[model samples]
Target: MDLAALGDCLGTSSCLIFQTVGGLKIGLLMFLVASGLTLIFGVLGVINFAHGSFYMLGAYLAWQTMALTDNFYLAVLAAALGVGLFGVLFERGFMSRVYRGDVLVQILLCYAFILILDDLVIIVWGEEFLSSLGIPDAFHRPPLFVGGAIVPVFHLFIIGFSTLVAVALWLFMTRTKWGKITRAAEQNPLMVSALGINTSLLFAGIFALGSLLAGLGGALAASERSISSGMGFSVVLESFIVTVIGGMGSIGGAFVAALLIGMTRSFGAIGFPLFTDGLMFVLMCLVLVLRPQGLMGRSGG
Candidate 1:
């Protein structure tokens, strides 16, 4: 395209509005995955390298569930609850022994799991890439005109659903007794353990909850992204980037960072398409240089 055409594209009101909404949808998807990874790190003090694999598993499970049941809601629930139960088993059976263990060992263990999941996916889904899922009947309605821009309803649904998850997560973490105890244990496990509470079971539950969130994110993306072996690896890097930019262990930080990256990618594509991928790295580098602790993270964390 000529410079004149590019100028017209950039200046259009509809173009800007559509890109804005698209960016928000992208960011929220990242938030859903990052929030889970951050929570596990914040409370468990363990970096869950296998979290992405859980997401990959969720995507496949969602595909299989929808294939067998043909129920969108059931597919979503099965993907989430299935991985959550898997999380509980993983935490109790494997992760429990590695608590406060060597960082290298933890990394290696999680890395091994990643490899294992990749192989399992290949065996089940085969080497060929699964086709992109069709938008369900509910989400297949005509695009709505917003500010003179046509916006897909599915995009709007992702934004609204992610917001609801965030709010519900906040309420669960603040208003409930279980939530209070979980927070307390993160800060003072020994104290909580001394109070006659079984911290082990609590940790397992938290881990499962985090896994559930990751699975849900993947399930939601099944229709938007192609399913393939090791699909989680693609978003895993972005999720970690979001976590780092948002401040490690801060869900709100993850949300904001995801949006920042999303917006950067969207608009950056218009001006610097060649450098779009690197823009997020530039943003992350700036954050590290200016605020090492992250936007919302406390110092020394």
Candidate 2:
């Protein structure tokens, strides 16, 4: 394309709107994964290196569930709940001993799990791209239109679902007793434990909840993208980047950073395609230089 064509593409109203919507979708997907990772880090004080593997497992499980039941909803539910249970077992059987252990030990334990889970996924799913077939026909059709630009209903649904999840999380964290205890434990676990709160149980629950969110993200993507081995590794890096940019352990920060990275990629593709991948890191670096603690993160933790 010539400069004139590129200029015209950049100036089109429909093009801009479509890109904005696309960016939001990407951001929402990242938020689903990053939110969980951040929550685990903030509350449990352990960096879950295997979180992405859980995401990959979720997608594979979703594929199998959809194949069996031929129902998209059931597949999603299975993926989330199954992965959550796996997380609980992991916390109880392995992570429990390493809780508050040396950072190196925690990292090694999680890293080992990542390798094990990767092999498990390959053994179960094989080395092929698993296609999503159980999606509703309506999801494939675009019902929304704007200025000659068509927008798929499924994309809109994803955005709506992500919003609902965010709201629900906020309510659970603020209104529920368990949520309150979880948050309080993050600040002072010893005190909470002294007060008769089962801190161990609370940590396990938080870990499971985080795993569930990651699984939900993976299941959501499985409907639109092909599932493959090592898929989680790529997203895990981005999720961590989002966590870092938003402020370690700040849910709201993760959300905002996800959007920022998404928009940067979308717009960068139009304006500076060559730098698209690096742009996110550049933004992250700038944020770090300006605010070491992150945009919303507290100074410590």
Candidate 3:
């Protein structure tokens, strides 16, 4: 090929690769947020409207921790633990009572919690939006050269970290004794209790784990977007859409749906411009109408 043609080909290839990688990163973030909502709704039968509130709490906590210690890594860890603890408290104190209630009641309870959390957040963090938590200055290494493209080191870190988290969650859910017990409880709580398992504790543990995942998602998102109070409502809606699009109880489904949604959003924004968000909703509605049970969801009752 001539020099101009070769350069054009290379540029097209690089752009495609960049878009793919960017979509994957966005998908991973969606998975992180949706996984928790799915688990909480699937296993505990709690809609957990406050799940998004926990995500906001995580971002605020991470911001505070980073300010205190000047360490991003430590801030993430602290945010996870703090939000996880909050989840435990929420489940044990309020949610446990509504376990056997109807979906409407559960939703009402969660909505009340949401109102409380919103006020609490405002009281603590005020109404100002925080700046993006960019990667540490010390770790701003030169981009990696690949063909005619240069990829930032931070992007690599995000992809690696997300992969590690996904693998870790998979291992925890499939390999551990606790994981098996939790799954059993989800399938049949009466049977799990009859088998001598403490169902309450199991439920609490799942809630904590789910909240930790949401917290991690929020902390990671802070690196790209400004932290704000209203962010919780926006992200929670997306997470709910993702949970429904995936099977409510299927982690693999969540992962797949996340990627689909992320890529659709990314391409829609670039290609459709004015109809970006609307395009996402249209896709969601189509999925709901055509495959209500989701791609990986179990069929039948």
Q: Order of all candidates by TM-score, from best down to worst? A: 1, 2, 3
Cand. 3 Cα-lDDT: 0.82
**Local error of candidate 1 at residue 14 (angstroms):** 1.4
- Per-prediction TM-score, please? 0.95, 0.94, 0.92
Off by over 4 Å in 2: 1-12
- Is candidate 1 or 3 superior in TM-score? 1
Q: What would the per-residue lDDT of candidate 3 be over residues 1-301, giving only the tens digit for each residue?
A: 1445334433686655665677778888888988998888778877788888889888888998988998999888998899999999999998998888888888899888878888887788887888877787765889876654567778777778887887888898899998888778778889999999888888898899899988998888887789887678988898888887887777878888888888776555556657767867887788789988877776664
- After TM-score superposition, what is the CA distance of residue 74 in candidate 2 from its true location, in Å? 0.5
Q: Mark the regions of model 3 whose C-alpha exceeds 4 Å error after superposition.
A: 1-11
| TM-score of model 3 (CA atoms) | 0.92
User: Which candidate order results from sorting by lDDT in descending order?
Assistant: 1, 2, 3
Q: What TM-score would you give candidate 1 relative to the actual structure?
A: 0.95
Better of 2 and 3 by TM-score: 2
Provide C-alpha RMSD values for all models, in order.
2.1, 2.1, 3.9
lDDT of 2 by residue, 1-301 (tens): 1445446656998877777788888999999999999999989888898899888888998999998988898899999999999999999999989986899999899889988888888888787778864456658664678765667778888888987898888888889999899888878889999999888889899999999999999999888888988889998999999999999888889989999998888777777778888989999999899998888899954
Whole-model lDDT values for every prediction: 0.88, 0.87, 0.82
Tell me the deviation in Å of residue 124 in model 1.
2.0
